[model samples]
Target chain A: MWGDKLSEGIMSIKEQLQNRFDELTRAEKQLTQLLLQNYPASGLGSITDLAKRSRVSTPTVARLVQKLGYTGFPQFQSVLRAEVGAELSNPIDKYNKWAEHAPDEHILNRFADSVSKNVRQTFSRLQTEEFDEVCALLANTDHRLTIVGGRISRSLADYMFTHMQVIRPRVTHMTSNSNAWPHYLLDMNKDDILVIFDVRRYENDLRRLAEMAHERGVKIILFTDQWGSPISKIAAHKFSCHIEVPSAWDSSIVPMLILEALIAKCKKRIGIKPGAGLTHWQACLTVRAYSESSLRAFSG
Target chain B: MWGDKLSEGIMSIKEQLQNRFDELTRAEKQLTQLLLQNYPASGLGSITDLAKRSRVSTPTVARLVQKLGYTGFPQFQSVLRAEVGAELSNPIDKYNKWAEHAPDEHILNRFADSVSKNVRQTFSRLQTEEFDEVCALLANTDHRLTIVGGRISRSLADYMFTHMQVIRPRVTHMTSNSNAWPHYLLDMNKDDILVIFDVRRYENDLRRLAEMAHERGVKIILFTDQWGSPISKIAAHKFSCHIEVPSAWDSSIVPMLILEALIAKCKKRIGIKPGAGLTHWQACLTVRAYSESSLRAFSG
Candidate 1:
């Protein structure tokens, strides 16, 4: 019990300063600002030097420290110094525990860093409104959905199509054979959603498909990269994520996040279960869905 | 220039204290220790209260504050207050710019948080050596690989199978139908590798498959969750990740990261292109691989 309190009691001096700044006197606030300006460097000096630097009297300085629960300048400096040490610890020390057999800059680490960064940057740049609007379209079971992916993104398209097929009806996954694409286009009605995953070295075939889909008044959601694919001009909703990583291949990390988020949201919107919506053919597909994600529901 | 310097100049006060702890006087150290013990709360009071709490003279406290470049206690407290405010800011505010159409509890933010946490936690727990060992097995062209996944995991299995086929010579993706298992087993050689994805509500057929594979001297690699599937006892390599999220379904976010990382690593290992390894059938398949992730290679 006592140990818990002791552990809980420890917070950094920076947090203390920030939390209690409102209680500071005018001179103290001025002094605090100066200290914060250079952080540890500003505070690593003697009392006389500090007072001189902040243009405050020695007594005033002493009074402020007492107010902050410090015995004197030495104690505060000690804590500040310790914090800086922790902050400056080598970044490599972290990797020591990461991947033992692989050296620094291994594909594992490189890809991890790039993928993590891409997820973060893309999320930061994503607008919630756009995501919500897309989810709303996905929830509308009145309209069918057609999914397609260029060379590499085929697996991703397949992934979405598989999961969506279980959660809702009226979804078709286009095969890699472009020859059969026209048949898919023929069935896509107005306001139907066509989700295309097309990344760089953008395929001419995909561009043409997008053009035809757009002409049919289909609401197209194009998942591309930071550069924004040419299809973006025609896409009703465009998710431009950062997909670059150190490896020869571009990452699908960010785009996949968005895709899953959409699936999850739509599943929420369309509150109906796979078992409830089942046809005999669909039942065969439904049995393969494991129990974890097996709960089928549509919020709409 | 000037703006950059100002940004660089700002370091946290916690960092300041921890890094320069050696410079403190005994009285100041005692007072600083007390302040840190309760953090912001310890320093929020008046000079008399804080000095008494720390059992230090007012002059000693003032001197310490000056030493930290604060004009007085008030100044130090002001900055501390601001930090607390920032720390305590409602997390929803950050999401305001996220999915505006959805409420705070929307699936987007919930899944995002859960997925991000799962990714970070799983990576932290993953052994780099284990990862390298898995990569070594994958890099070995002498061994053919057979991939399988349970209901929901089939897409992931398909994902790995699709990419692996493009990267290596002999790889087979089993369909969801259990009746086809024996046919695949008959083709499996003693040294062939089997990759299985089995999560909660672990299937009986997959366990039987792993058993048959194990009996045949086929190496097994399993991707599971923290609870670990029963297959771990029989499988040679197991990747157990955290899959829980706020939603009803389990997340594949962490497992997918590991999968992609493995693909990136193996691609580096194989050192061969689809074009170079192309048989007539493979050439047809190669035509679809767009530019990114298009460079196929095996390092080993």
Candidate 2:
């Protein structure tokens, strides 16, 4: 890789420093580390000031940039600024690192592994008594079930709410932003069951909804990752699981799978039998599937 | 779990049969199996026909209603129909076998396992030569990059496009479903890279866009789960991974992680320096965070 290295055109300043890291005197080494660790500050620093911090001469600072592969101090600073900007835009690497540590496997196997891990963690950490109690409360509720999730969690909430509504036929998903959810909460009552999926630090809007549900005497079933997450404290019943994937970015799918299991449990509770209702559901699927296929065909 | 006692409440016909399965005489075993396996058909079958199929007496079929905890055949059929409807509405579960399995540690772990498995399978199945060629193409592209994804995959595309844009400032994210994207693509040329994240069965609009990009001689990079999936064949450059999740309900985070890896590679290719053009991104975050906090404080 090094042999076919920078074609002289875009050779970065960092590359130049690597080429001469050991050859440089002690003062140059200090300057290099300082620049690498605090490149942003270097962009705004003058040659004299940067040399003072690195304990190097002003001429040595300029020489460091050239050796680092930059045309000059200004060019080196531009590269530094760009690198800092890229980091600020996306923190995905931290999230993906968790996947890298796991052994290689197929998508199906990976899915199974992820879900099983989530279920185990959730079950072990969970107070089964509380889970069953929440189930009991939900089972007894006469009013509709309402689910709330936002950002990345919204897709799971939408799917769960859609299926639950079909099976139990009274589930509603709240689609509004955090601030707007209170209006929806107004429609909920003591008989209603409110399910909230919030992870990590927890969003203020979801926390507010959890609080309001408590005040309204509505049963709240909380699914979150962080133990100290704000939503956990106020929930009437809670299922906590760790989704500590390496990154600061949240790429965990535990919450979504939890919703899937909840839907399954709900199905079992509601009782899936075989007869006219089942036939009706099949009929509905057929019609829906046909419509979907036809739409795709036409659109194509 | 069943005693000779039956609860004096309405129960689905299938449940009734499960309760009465042991009580049925030897002659009714076949009938019970038939009812459990094909509940809908058994519900509609006449007593004589059901008896003939089960090789039992008509009296035995007649006794099934009371034994199964139903008032009559009609009531039994109603429960059967309800079960059938519920089954049709939720078709993913081919069996109740999952209940037989042990629950694992955490949902995240299960998801990771699933992803790792898929990654291994995908890696083995992937055409290395094609992957390298595509990476080389992407690395060499002179024009801005454009990415598109919808539904759950949108997060992955958004993640990839955001990171890539910082490395190459001309990247565009086509997020909305509006027809606005066609106008944007009209100007794309051979120099520009158009990346599509199409997993599973290819989405409709994405297929059309891929076809359009191909026709225009625009460089196309496709990231997909399955190799034979419709989107795979059309791309000028393709990378396949096992993105299938257990739920078949889109609950896995593997694809998002794959996007992360791809972004990391792209970052390496373009040389993600520490201080590069980062103030703009940080400034945006700072502004948004400050404004949001200020707004909250003001309201309080």
Candidate 3:
């Protein structure tokens, strides 16, 4: 029970500091600064040495340790060591025991929290002026919106493009017709919006397309991580959001949130509202009714 | 906001009753019982009739309203009306604004709470004796394990079955050879384990397979939302859980938790401890090297 309480204390400290590191006291801030800056060395060092290096008094270090919610210095060090170990793990590795220790609630909370952060970040980064411009571009009759993304990112792009296409009728998704992507890009009017998702540095194809689109005077909205990424450099409008999760796993939260926001924005602007009180099941039935004739014709 | 808060208050009452319904006095219990027995009606009714019908006196009824954390009977009735209206809307509808309302810490807490609840409920429902029986069945040399699902459910099942296949080297997933499913089902031995996931009941294939497997004396393990459903009735072992989601929308917390628990249990029994002295990166690289190659091969 003591150990559990101590762990909770330290965990709470880690959490609070994580959220409010900027608001900590000078000594605590100094220690946190040292921990954040020279995390490797400080994380490895003993309490005395950490105190000496961070330029805080030994008791200050101890107090900072307590403030971080650890019973003393040792527990904090152990947690720091584990975190370093996690960070040093390969990016492609599947997280194993992380979820094992986490209850469903914890995973749900983390997932929800992470998703909320992604959504909030996306929402904040989305300027109202830019959003209006994009909406206006889509609202135009002559130009078509071109979306580019592949793999999991493709799924999101496709979903957004499809939903928008139902209302806009001219949104062209690249992956849906990959062979014609270049043609679609080339044929797009200068006023057309090029919506590209190039999360992580992995998708060079997307980055190249965004560059080409930008060069051709197409307005590009690039959803990529970090400011210095290649895609951000060429795109006319860059929306930064984190998709490379710390746990070395794909997160649906970012894409799902982004798509929902985009849909919300589009629906709000264009007066589209899921066919105006049509039940989801009724919509499905309509889809089936239309598709069934074609399917039967083809089969017959 | 007032309507939302009022309904939230009633929800809190329902939650409290859910926790301690068995301990209420006869009159109080009767009121609680009426509310529970006919939630739809109570959710729609005015305070006077609801109280009178439940056999609780006026003061007692007022106290019940107060106990539920409302301002008064009228406030409580307003909440109940809202709840009933909400229920009438659709039970499975996606909460698009669920994240919008949840800020950073709260989102994390709610997600954590959901995950914890799912895990606890899953664990609670899990029988150690059944687990032993399952282990024995799997450990039996004669039994071939067959698993199947589609779309997102398929992805999760494939994840679990693939891991099990790697360690056990005998289990067959339906996705392995789609053509072979019916043939394999027809040839099912009495010792075979047919694990079926019928989340949302989207597919009839799983139910059909389970029934055929059962008729042939094959051991069945079914994970589904409700008891006495098609898959559940045919299974030797039935695990019940609620997805509580709308049509064709697969985002769920409970199903994934159950999948993880099953894998953890099996992996633990198989004695697949984290290979000794492996750095996190090394373990990741080990898994990645193989998974990436397989992913490439599958894609190709």
The lDDT leader among the candidates is 1
Best by DockQ: 1
Summarize candidate 3's per-residue lDDT along A1-300 as a digit string, tens digits: 366544654453334454344346657766765564333334445567678887888898888767755788767655654554344343332222123234434433344345445545554454545545655666564666778774345645655665566555567777633444566666765777888876653454565566667777888876666443587767776656555432333454444444444454555455533445764335545664443222122222
What is the interface root-mean-square deviation of candidate 1? 13.8
Q: Each candidate: what lDDT?
A: 0.72, 0.57, 0.54
Error of 2 at A162 (Å): 6.4
Give the C-alpha interface root-mean-square deviation per candidate.
13.8, 24.1, 20.1
Decide which is better by lDDT, 2 or 3: 2
For the predicted complex of model 3, DockQ is 0.02
Candidates 1 onward: DockQ, in order: 0.11, 0.01, 0.02
Better of 2 and 3 by TM-score: 2
TM-score ranking from best candidate downward: 1, 2, 3
Question: Which candidate wins on TM-score?
Answer: 1
